[model samples]
Target chain A: MANQPSIHAGVRALARLKKRRRSEAIFRAFGIAAIVFAMCALAWLLGSIIGTGYKAFYQHSLTLEVELTESILAPNGSRDPDTLRRANYRRIMQEAMFTRFPDIEGLSSADQRAAKRQNFDIMSTSGGPNYIRQMVFKDPAMVGQTITVRIPTSDIVDQYLKGNLNVDVPEVQRKISDRQIAWVKTLRQSGEIKAGFNKRLLFSTDSRDPELAGIASSFVGSLMTMFVTFLLAFPVGVGAAIWLDEFAPKNKAVDFIEININNLAAVPSIVFGLLGLAVLLNWAGMPRSAPIVGGIVLALRTFPTIIIATRSALRAVPPSIRDGALSVGASHVQAVFHHKLPMAAPGILTGSIIGMAQALGETAPLLMIGMVAFLTEIPSSLTEPATALPVQIYLWSDSAEQAWSERTSAAIIILLMVLVTMNGIAIWLRSRLEKRW
Target chain B: MTENTSKNIKFTCRDVRVSYSGKEAVKGIDIEIADRSVTAFIGPSGCGKSSFLRVFNRMNDTIPGCAVTGDIRMDGEDIYAPGLDPVLLRARVGMVFQKPNPFPKSIYDNVAYGPRIHGLAESKADLDEIVHNSLKRAGLWDEVKDRLKDSGTGLSGGQQQRLVIARAIAVSPEVILMDEPASALDPIATAKLEVLIEELKEKFCIVIVTHSMAQAARISQKTAFFHMGDLVEYDETDQIFTNPAELRTQDYIMGRTG
Candidate 1:
C-alpha cells in the first residue's frame, strides 16, 4: 500500500475514468435515440392518418332550383302525409338536372337518354332524394314553389373535388366520365356547387352510399358497451382483489387460484369471445350482435386486467396502515374498507380507465361476437343489435372504395381521440387524488 | 432477585410461546403485569420483545403462519377462549407501533376512529367529547386543538405518536401496549413521549418494549430482560439496573453485550 501511486490523476485511473464517462455518454445517447425514434414513428402515423382523413369531413354539393310540380307530387291534389311521402321526387330531381342542361334535347333519342342518365349521376341519389322527400313532407304548402336547396354530389365527385382522385389518369380508368366532370366544373365556375361540412358523416348511420355514411350508431354502441363493461368489471374486480389480498388464507388452494388469475390475464382475448359465443349466444339464446352480448364479452376480457391492477394497488398501501386500523379494534372488513381501500382508490381508478380504453380499441373479440355486422340503424337499447366503433372502422377499411378508405381513416382518428381522452382522464385523476403517503 | 408481585395484576401469562411458521420466536415464559403501572421489556434487536408485546393484543394473529400457544389471561379471563373475539380483545387492549402511524385522515377522525368503530359514542357531541378528552389525556390537545380538521399525517413525529396513543385510548381500553414508540424520535421528542407515557400510566396499564436501556430505566417501574427468545430476568426497575442477578441481564445493562 505504501508503494502504491497516488490514485488521483494517475495514468491508469484517468484512463478508467475516461472509459467510464464514455460508456455513460454512449448509454445516454442510446436512450435519447430510442425516445426520438418513438416520437418520429408516432408523428409519421398521425401525419398520414390526418392527411387522408381531413378530406372525409367535408364534401361538395350543388345548389339546385328545383320546380316541385304539384301535378307530379300530388296528382289528386291531396295534401296527406302518405301521399306526399309517395310522391315522384326522383322525376322532379331528374327534370331539375335536365333544365340545368337543356343541350341534351339537341341529341339523338338514344344519346339523349344516355346524357340524361349521366346528368342524374352528378347528384347524390339517396341524400338529395331523401332531403326533398323530408322537406316537402314537412311543408306540404310549398309543393308548387320553386325552391333553391343544397344537395350533396356523388361520392366520386366529392372525392374528385377533394383532390384525392387524379384527373391525369386515362378517361377509361377514371370513375368520373368527361361529360359528368364537365358539368361539375361548369357548376363550380357558376358558384352553384361548393365544398361544405359533411353533416351526414356525423348525424346519419351506415349506408351503402359512402356519401351518406356516419358514425352515430357505432359511437353510441361503444358508449353503451363501455358503460356495461365498467359496471360489471369494477365492483367485481375490486372485490376479488380485496378478498385475495387481505382476507384469503395463504394455502395451496389460494395459491392455485392466484396463479390461474394471473394466467387468465395473459390468455388471448378472442378466446373470451368464443366463450361468449357458446354460452351467451348459443346456450342462453341471447341476441347476437347486441351491445349486451358485446359488453359481456369485453367484461370477461377486461376482468383479469382490472383484478391484477387492483391487487397491485392494494399491495402498494403500506402494511402499517392496516395494522393501525386493526390495532384500533376495527374488524378486518372495516380495516380494509375504511383505510386501505380508500388509499388504493386512485390507483384502482387509473387501472380501470386504462383497461376500458383497451376494451374500446379491441376488435378481434368483437368480431367473434358478430358485432362486425353492417348495422344501418342506431340501437336504442342494450338488447338491440349494434356495432362498435372499432368494428365499424374494420368494416369500412375492408371496403373496395376510395371514399370508404378516407372514412376509415377518419373513424380511426375519432377512436384514437377517445382513447387519448380516456388516458388523459386517468392521468389527471391519478395526479388529483394521489396522496403523498 | 426477589419476586416483585402486585395484587392488582392485569395480565398473567403461563408458559406462553410464539412461533412463526413452526420456528419459535418467543419461547416459554411466565410473567405478570400489574394494573395501572409501566412495565418495560428490554433486549437487543430480534430478541422477541416486540413479538411478546404483540401477543397481548393478538396483533401477531394477523401475520400469516404466526401462532401463539399456552395460557394468557386478562383480569383472570382467558383471552384465547374460543368465544372471545380477537376484535373485542383488541379494543380492550390497544397497541402503538415503533413508527408513528397516524391514519391519513383529519386529527379528529383519527382519534374518533376507535370510539366510532366500537360504538362507544352515540352522537356527534359524544364523539367530540371522547376525542377531546383522549387527546387531552395523551398530552396532545393543546398543540392540536385548533387543527382538528387537519390531516393527522401532517403532524411532526412526536405529535403523530401522541395522536396514535390518543387514538388507542379513545376506545377506553384497560391496557395499552407500545412497541418502541420513541425509537424513531429525536432526543427532544423522546423526552416528550416519556413524559406522556408517565402521565398515562395513572389510568391504564402500560407495557413498552424498548432498545434503549436508559429509557427503560427512566420510564419503567418494572423491567424484563430478554435474550435469545428467553426472559433472563424480571424485577423492579431499580433492582434490575443496580443488582441484576442474571449474568446476561448484567452484561446487557452494563453495555458490554447486546
Candidate 2:
C-alpha cells in the first residue's frame, strides 16, 4: 500500500482530482438531465393532447322543428323492392326530431321573432351514410320538404364554441349570426346546446363530412384483424416453439431457423405492410381492404415474438422435470403440454398478450392492405372495408381542420388506454400463473 | 410382453454402450440389478454412474443426440426390444433426480399427476387415496397434512425431495431409479432419504447413483464402482468397501484417489 503513488505528485494530483469526482459528477448530471428532458417532452405531448381532446367529447349542432311525410321517405310508394331494403333512415330521422321539437313548425315572418331551439341529437355515423344516403337520394320530394333536421355544426362553428373565436373576430369571417348565437344561448339554457358523450363515435357508419366521422367503423376492422391474428398466430407459433424447444434435435437447420425467426421479429412493420400488399392483396387476390388481409399481415408480424417468448419459457423448465415425466410414462407431447407446458403457461400467455396488443395497435401493415380506407359503416363482416384507431388518428391528424387535430389526439388517447389495459391484463395473467411458483 | 412373464425378474445387461454424438460416454458394460433390492452405483465426478442409471429406463432418450445400444432385459424379456414404447418403459421404471424436482403444483396434485396419467385412479376418491398412500410411503403426509394443496415447491429441500419420491411412487412403478437423489441435501436429509430408500425396496427395486462412497457403502446391498466410462468392480457393498478387486477401485477406496 505504501508503494502506491501519493496525492502530492503535483500535476498527477490535479489530473486525479479532475478524474476522481468532477468527471463522474458531470456524467451523472448529464444522464439525469437527459432523463428529465425526456420526461418533459413526454409530459408536454400528453398535456397538450389531453387539453385539446377533452373538447371532442362535446359537439355543437343546430336543431329545427319541421314535419316529416311518408312521401319524403318512400317516394312513389309502389316500390316493393326499395322497402325491402333498409328503411329510409334520413326521412325517419327528420320525423323523429320534429316529433321531439314542435316549436319550429311555423315559418318566421319577422327578424325579431324568436325561434324555438333544442339541444340537437343525431345517431351520428361515419363515412358514406349507408342507408340514409340511399333513402334521401331515392325520393325527389324529400329534397324540398320543410322537415326539421338536427345537423352537425361546421368546423368554424365548432371552433367558436371551443373558445377559438373571440370578441374581436371579423363579422364576415364569423360562422354564426347574432340570432344563431342567441339561439345557441337559448338552447344552452334549455340544456340542449352543450357537449356530451358521442356514443356512436365508436360504432357508427361514416358520414360524407368529417362532422359525422366516428371510430366505430374502424373498431370492427381492428376486431376482425385481431381475430385472424389470434387464430393463425397462436397455434402456429406455440406449436413451432414447442417442437423446436422440446423435440427437435440440435442441428444446423434448427440453428438457422432460430436466427431467422429472431431476425423476422425485428423486421420493420412497413416492410411487412408492403409484403402483405404485394403477396396477399395483389397476387393472392384476397379482398383489397378486408380485415382478413390485415390480420394475415399482423399474424406474420406477431408470430416471431410469440415464438421467441414461448421458446425461452420452455427452455426455462428444468431438465429433471422432463426426465421425470419421461420416466413416469409421459410421452414427449404429454410431458411438454401436460407437465412442462403447464409450468410454462404464464410466460406463454404473457407473450400471447404482447403479440395481440401489438397486432391490435398496428396500422402500417393495415394501411398497406387498404384497411385505411374511409369506411363509414360498422363492419358487418371480415371482408368489409374499414379502418383501425391508429390509422384513424393518422387520417384525422393529416386533415387541414384544427378540429380533427383534437380528434386525432383523442384517438391517440384511446389507443394508449387500450394498450395500457391489455398490458394490465397480461400482467394479471402472469401473476396468476406465477402463483404456482 | 407375454402373459406368463414373471414380474419379479431382475435386470440383466450385456455389453451396453451409450454414446452422445459419436463420443462414448459409457463404454461397453455388463450389469445385473436384482429385483426388490437396493443396488447402488458409486463413482467420482464424470465417471458415468448417473449415465448408467439413465440407461435402465432409457431415460437417455430425452437427451438430444444421445444413443444407446446393447441388451438390457427384465423378466426374461428384452426391455430394449425394437417395439418397446419409451413411455411404457418409463412407466415401469420411475426416476428421481439429483435435485428435488417437485412440479410447480400443489403437493396433492404432484402425487396425483403420475397416477392420473397412468389411469391408476378410477375416481376422485381413489385419486385421493393414491396421493395419501404415496405421501405416506415417502414419510411426508403427517408433516404436510394441513396444506396438501400448497405448492410442492414450497416445502423445505428435504420435504420437496420426499414429495418427488412420493410422486414417483404414485404411479405404482415396478422400479425406481434415483440419480444422486440426496446429492444436494444436507446430512440429516440424506440420512432421511437413505432410510426412506430402504423402506421402498420392499415393494419395488431401488437403483441409486451416488458420488458419496460412504453413502453407497452404508445403504446399498450391492455396489458397482465405475471409473471413467468403465465398470471397474461389482461386489457386495461390504466387500467392495472393505476389499475391492481392481487397482482403480482399490485406489479409490484408499483415497489415492478418485
Candidate 3:
C-alpha cells in the first residue's frame, strides 16, 4: 500500500484485481448453493417416501366375536392345527361376518348396508391363521364362545384413514355414504374403528384391488428370481472378470470382447426383454410368464454390470500383490483367486447388490417377458407366472379404477422400501468387509 | 559353454539384444550369476537394471511387442525354452517388487495366500501354522500376532513391507528375486529389510536390483555393475568397490560420471 502507484494505469489495475476477487466469491457462493439445493432435493424425496409408504405395512380393523359353532369350524369340532390349516380360513372369515351381522335381515335391501359392511375378511390369509391359532391355542374355552376376532373393514373405510377420502368432500365423491360415515363416527366414539397397524399385508396375494391386495406370491417370486440370478450371474461374472483382468492375453479377440461388454452395458433394458420373449418363451417353449424367465432376463440385464465391477475390483489389487504371490511359487491362477479376488470382495458384493436391486425394480423388461399378468395361485416353483412390486405398480397405474391409483402409490411405497432395505444391507455388508479387509 | 569352470547359472550372450519394435533399449548384456548367496545389480538411471531383472522371469511377457534375444539358463536349462509355462516358472522363481504390496486382506491371509495356491498347506489349520511361522522368521510375529485378523494394509509401512517379505517366504521358493525391495522405504524400514535379506540369503539364492551403491555394498555378498544395458563387472562386493576391473565401474564407484 505504501508503494502503491499514483498513475491512472496502476489505479485501473487495482480496480480490475478487486473485480476479479468479487466475481470469484460470487462463483463460489453459487457453487455452494447448488450443492445445498441437490442435498435438499434428496432429503425431500426420502421424507415423502417414508411418510406415505409407512401405511402400506399396516391395517385398521374391528374385533367382533362370532361363536366358532361346530357347523362353521370343523363341521364337527376336530380342533387340529393341520386340520384348521386345511379347513378354509376364508370360509370361516365369511361365516363369522354373516353370523355377526345376522341383523342384515335381507341381503338385497339397502336398509341393512351397515350390517353387510361388517363382514370383511381380516383374518383369513396365512398370517391371519396365526392369530386365529393363537386365540384357539391360548384358551380352548374361547373357541365355542363369542371370542373377539379382528376382522378387516371395507376399502371405503381404509381410504378414510389413508387420506384418500377427503373429509371435507361432498357425499357424492366419497365411497362411504354419509349415513355409514356417521355410523363410523359413532364407532370411532365407541373406540372400535380406530386406525391401527395392518399385520395381514405380508401374506396376502396381490388383489384385483390394491386396497385388499397382499404380496405373498410377489414376495415369493422376487425370492426365486434372486435365487436364480445369484446362481447364474455371480459365478459366471466373477469367473469371466478374473480371467479377463488377470490371465487373458491382450490380443485383438480380448479387445473385441472388452468393447462388446461396454456396448452391452449401454443396451436398453427393453431390448433385453425382447430377446427373452423370443428365446425363452417363443422358440424354447419354456414356461410362459414364469419368474425363471423374468430372472433370466434380469440376469442378462445384470451380468455386464457385475462383470465390469468385478474386473475393476480385480484391477485395483496392486500388481505387487500378484508378484508377491507368484514369487512365493504360486501359479498365476493361484495368485489371482487366492490373493486378488478375496481382496476385491467388498467391491464385488457392492456391485452384486446394486445389480440385484436394479433387477428387483425393473419392470419394462420383465413386462415383455410376461411377468405382469394375473397370478392368483401361490407359486410352487419358479415356473409360476408372477408379478414383482414394480410390475404390480405398472399394472395398477394403467387401470381405470380410482382405487387402483392408491394401489399404485402403495406399490411404489413398497418398492421404495425394499430398495431402501437392500441399500441398507449393502452398507452393512460393506462395513463388515471393510473392518476385516 | 559346458567346459566353463563355474557350475553357476550363466547367461550366454552372443550379440544379445532387447528392443521395442525398432528402438533398442538394452543394447547387449553378458554375465554369469553365482550359484548362491546374494548378488546385487547396481546401476544409474536408465541403465536398464529393472529391464534386465524382468528378462530373468520373463515378466516383460505382459508388455506387448517387448522382444528379448539371448540364451539365459538355470543350470543349463534354457529359461526361454519353447512351451515353458511362465505360470509354472514363476512358482519356482519368485519375485518381490519395489513397493511393498500386501493384499487387502488379514495379516494371516496375506502370508497364507501363496502357500494356499501352491497347495503347500493341506488344510486350513495347517495353512494357519505356516503363515504363523513365516511371520515369525521375518521378525514380525511379536508385533502382528495380536492383530492377525486385521487387514495387512492397515500396518505401518515397515510392518507392511515385512509382511510382504513373509508372504514371499510362505511359498518356500528356492530362489528369491527382489527388485529394489527397500527403495520405497524409510531409513529404519530399509535397515530392517537389509537385515532380513542377510538372514534370507542363508536358505534362498537371492538377486537384488538397486540404485544405491552404499546399500549394495552394505547387503550383497557379490556386486555386479551394469551400465547402458551391459554388465561392466562382477566380483566380490568389497573387491568390486575397492578395485573395479572396468573403467565405467571405476568411474561409478568413485562418483565421477555416474
By TM-score, the best candidate is 1
Tens-digit lDDT string for candidate 1 (B2-51): 33334599999999999999999999989999988899999988889899
Model 2 deviation from native, Cα RMSD in Å: 6.5
Per-residue lDDT over A1-437 for candidate 2, one digit per residue giving the tens place of the 0 to 100 score: 77887777779888888787988999999999999999999999889999988777677764544443556545566445455254455445545444654555665645213332221223232211343445455654454355544555555556666786663666556645554565456665775555656554454545445556678777777778888889999999999999888777788998999899999999999889999999987899898888888888999999999999898888877777777677778888888887788888889989988999988888788788888788757788888787777888888888877677777777788788888898999999988777443
Each prediction's Cα lDDT score? 0.92, 0.78, 0.74
Each model's TM-score, in the order given?
0.97, 0.83, 0.81
Best prediction by lDDT: 1
Q: After superposition, how far is residue A300 of candidate 3 from its true place, in Å?
A: 0.4
Better of 1 and 3 by DockQ: 1
Model 3: CAPRI class: acceptable
The model with the greater TM-score, 1 or 3, is: 1
lDDT of 3 by residue, B15-59 (tens): 456777656677777766765578899988777778777777777
i-RMSD per candidate, Å: 0.7, 1.7, 2.9
lDDT value, residue A27 of candidate 2? 92
Error at A121, model 3, angstroms: 14
Per-candidate RMSD, Å: 2.0, 6.5, 6.1
DockQ list for all candidates: 0.82, 0.55, 0.45
